[model samples]
Target: MAEFWERYAEININDRQRKVLNKLLVADPDDFEGGISNKKHISMTNASSATATRDLKTPVETRMLVQSGGGRKARYGIDWVGITS
Candidate 1:
């Protein structure tokens, strides 16, 4: 939605965050997790594990991404309503 994009554009997301967000946006719901881990982000962005972790943090804080689990088991997904509202 244009509203969502506008709000997203106002955020201070970096390249990694943008990439991860795009992946999550287009991912099939069934394949969303694939497993609760940051490896998905690392593989998608070719980023280091630490970089992926940091990249994900801003989205979570801004409610663009919802995070669950803990540590290496953590997972992330798009917050559809959060963004579009």
Candidate 2:
């Protein structure tokens, strides 16, 4: 976890983004079968859809998360390789 945060030391991850990232870090793989959806992010962060959408972008841009699908099916997963390396 310390190493993971170190990788993003140069990125500015806000409270909501931090919350979601922490959740993802400790979450069971089964809980996120296809990664985290916008709807799930909303539920976890108590953020509006627009806010969730915006918050999710930073990690993707920083290569912390990888996106998949589109629209209602869109999901995001921590880039294990990106961080591990």
Candidate 3:
């Protein structure tokens, strides 16, 4: 998620994206089923511009619901920051 916060944008994701992101947020990062394997993944592909990152300079909006710790760390709060609940 650090990579995303460094170069991400403010995106208002749709319904499907919300559901998928919700599932992936709390789930373990290493967990296979926890990733974006749900039906909502397609929506992410369709709306590439919404979440896709152009480069380090260009910001890309991601759907990260759960965030990390403090101390100069980056928190990816998808439902909270990326997309409003």
Candidate 4:
């Protein structure tokens, strides 16, 4: 399970996002935070925010697109919280 965190935390997440994951997912896997979504999501890297649309512009598309907005559309995958391929 430690390996899972290594992969997930590798993504550059904001302070708020970090708190969410650390509290909700990593620290207590069974603990559910108020209003925090346990849906499919990922932590984004600097590259994502730097993109034109904050989207990964590559021939090989990524699982989750960049979400620059707040709420659900504000998260992007960075293989940190990503499932190992």
Clashing residue pairs in all predictions, respectively, total 0, 0, 1, 4
Q: Ten-residue segment with the worst summed lDDT in candidate 1?
A: 28-37
Question: Which 10-residue span in candidate 4 carries the lowest summed lDDT?
Answer: 57-66
lDDT (Cα, 0-100) at 61 in candidate 3: 33
Candidates sorted on TM-score, descending? 2, 1, 4, 3
In model 4, the number of clashes is 4
Tens digit of lDDT per residue, candidate 4, span 1-85?
A: 4554555454554454444334433444334322222142223222333442322332013322233345444333333335553
Query: Each prediction's TM-score against the native?
Result: 0.81, 0.92, 0.30, 0.31
Model 4 RMSD in Å is: 9.1
lDDT of each: 0.74, 0.89, 0.38, 0.36
Pick by lDDT: 1 or 4, better one: 1
Candidate RMSDs in order: 2.4, 1.5, 10.7, 9.1
Residue 64's lDDT in candidate 1: 80
lDDT of 1 at 41: 83
Name model 3 segments beyond 4 Å from true. 1-9, 37-85
Error of 4 at 26 (Å): 4.6
The lDDT leader among the candidates is: 2
TM-score result, candidate 3: 0.30
**What lDDT score is found at residue 80 in candidate 4?**
36
lDDT of 3 by residue, 1-85 (tens): 4444343336555555544444454456554232332123444445443342221011113334443443223333343454322
Give the clashing residue pairs of candidate 2, or none.
none
lDDT of 2 at 68: 95
